[model samples]
Target chain A: MAKNTSLYEKHLAAGGKMVDFAGWEMPIHYGSQLEEHHQVRRDAGIFDVSHMTIIDLSGREVRGFLQKLLANDVNRLKKKGKALYSCMLNEKAGVIDDLIIYYMHDDWYRMIVNAATRNKDLTWIEKQAQNFEINIDERPDLAMLAVQGPNAREKAHKALGNKILAAQDLTPFFAVDCGEIFVGRTGYTGEDGYEIVLPSQQVPQLWDDLLTAGIEPIGLGARDTLRLEAGMNLYGQDMDESTNPLESGLAWTIAWQPEDRDFIGRGVLQKLRDSGPNNKLVGLVLQERGVLRNHQKVIVDGVGEGEITSGSFSPTLKCAIALARVPAQTEDQCHVEIRGEKRSAKVVKPSFVRFGQSCID
Target chain B: MSNVPDNLKYTKTHEWIRQESDGTLTIGVTDHAQGLLGDMVFVEVPDVDANFNSGDDCAVVESVKAASDVYCPVSGEITETNEALADTPEMVNNDPFGDGWLFKLRPTDPNEISTLLDANGYQEIIAEDSH
Candidate 1:
């Protein structure tokens, strides 16, 4: 049986179509997914992201432990409630998971990881913490909700009341805590929003209150399209334990400053960085009528073969877009084998849309 | 509850057929199929005048989540396709029975239509599948 989020009953009552995702029974859509996508792009929408794992690290040596655990430099987060996006890699420099870490104090930090990689991430973190003096605590007692879009802050503030003011004043990539709830000015949809983590028992009431405040409940379907349009990578698809961040269009997330910091996978990543990656991830826009799909073979005329990692009809762009791993030298245009026919597609930067606007020319 | 019009015929794959007065038949995916597929983004209709065997996958309906094949219910020659759906595939979700009709076919055997599931039979199939 799939696990249920704290708001599962409320989702069913609201007519959400529930599907098994990452072992959790989560809503795929309340109704038309296209409309939900438009809602997040044009107005405001909320997503039940409680399935995402939240882990808090505390101890005198927490800061030092994180410095060696993440690919990004947590030392850059000097201010309290500042968040950093980083990829945790294995010894081979292959990405294990991408997560967001929020620094609350010198000895206290919070991390949110992908739902599908919960077990693997926790195990890895625990194993790495054995040598350190930090306490690894997975906080399943908390539930998360992401309110996103252009008017997201306004609506969330209306529902959450003055408690959200601290979050409202927060800059991008920053966070604030109000009592038991922690609100972060961050999201995966490339829209201005807040991700609030609260006590698990309060989720259903908050969900209902948000609905009363006119915030539409968006599901996983639109979430995928929105993230893809924003050029965000999905774990297990864009990259995994066997794929390094360099080839997955995530080289920017790696922090190389303080050269002698000696983080895990630093040696392998340094070597790969000097030589460069063989295959690169690029965006493809289908020039024809068909939809792009994962695993479709991409053929570059003189370069070589590549494969699509994530593909879908972008609701915001009204066109088929995809992320594909191709030869580092491939550029401009390529042919994608859809069904059995080779259809032409335009190659561009991996992002097609952002902040409700088309980013691709 | 699903919309199973008593006047139409249905296949297990969730397509409905209506025999026209001129021995031709109009076909479209059932409302249940469209609901299951969510919003349609692109639809590939069979070419006019193409011949197909019964149960052949002749067309495709794609939504944001997945792509599903639309099968021909009976052996027939395609006569017309709803070209408007190429630009406005959402018709399949908005009006699966009326403006969303996929294609018109001149049946090879009009009697074959009688062998399809009736409204009651189709509802039973949908109920069983849901379970």
Candidate 2:
């Protein structure tokens, strides 16, 4: 049997097509995925992200524990409610999971990891924390909602009522606490929005209030296209236990400034950083009428070969775009083998769209 | 429940066929198939005059998330395809029985029609499959 979120009944009432997602029965779409995708870019949309795993860590050595567990430095987050995105790596420099860490204080911090990788991520985090004086507790009682789009903030504020005032003026990458609710000014979609975490029991009311506010309910379908168009990497698809951050277009997330910070897999990453990653993740725009799909072969002429990690039709760009792992020397153009035919594609920066605008040139 | 027009015939693989006055069979994925596929982004229609054996892979339909192969329901030579789908593949979701027809083919074995499922039989197939 699949797990159900607090909004499962609401999803059924709203005509959502329920499907199994990471062991949870989630909505794939309400009526049409394309329309939902467009709605987020044009207006605002809400998604039930409660299935994502949230873990809380508190102790005298919380800061030190995170510094050693995550590849990104938490020392930069001096202010409370500041969030950092980092890839939790294994000893071989392979990515275990990519997640967001929200700083509440030196002793108390919250981390949200992917749903599919919950078991392993927890085991890994717990194993790393045994030596240090820390308490790692999973917050299964919490529910998370991501309200994203150009007008996402206003609509979310309207749905959330007075509690949103604390998050109203939040800058990007910052989070705020209003009693029992926590709002992070960050999202997977490249749109301005808030990822609100609250008590699971209180989510149904918020979900209904957001619907009454005219914010469309986005399903997992549109959630994927939106993220792909934004050039964001999906955990299992873009990178996994077999891949590392340097080759996954996540080199920017690594904080190597303080060489003394001996995080997990630091030595391997340091060697790769100096030698440079041989394969790079890049964006591909189909020069013809075709949909780019994952695992498709990509051939870089006279250079090398590669494969698409995440590919989809970008409703925002009105064309097919994909993120491909190709030989780092590839430039300007390549070809994707779709079916039995080789189609031309243009290579560009991994980010295809951002802030409701096409970032492609 | 999916709409299964009484006038058409369906295959076990979720394709609907309608025999035109010219004896050419028009084929497309069933309504339930399109609904399962969500929204369509692109369709690769088979070329005119292309010949295929029954159950042979002919064209492709891609939704935003994945691609599915469209199989030829019966052996025939392709007569026409829905060119409009090249620009607007959502026709598959909007009118899977009408404007969304994938291709038209002249049947080589007209007797094969008797082996195809009627609306009721096709409905049962979808129902049992879901169970």
lDDT of 2 at B33: 95
Model 1, which residues run further than 4 Å from truth?
none
Q: How much is the lDDT of residue A282 in candidate 1? A: 93
The regions of model 2 sitting more than 4 angstroms off are none
lDDT of each: 0.93, 0.93
True-vs-predicted CA distance for residue A113, candidate 2, Å: 0.6
Clashes of each: 0, 0
lDDT at residue B122 of model 1 (Cα atoms)? 96
Per-residue lDDT tens digits of candidate 1, residues B79-115?
9999999999999999999999999999999889888
- Fold similarity of candidate 1's chain A to the true chain A, as a TM-score: 0.99
lDDT of 2 by residue, B1-131 (tens): 78989999999988899999999999999999998888898899999999999999999998886789988988999999999999889999999998999999999999988889999999899999899
Worst 10 residues of 1 chain A by lDDT: A160-169
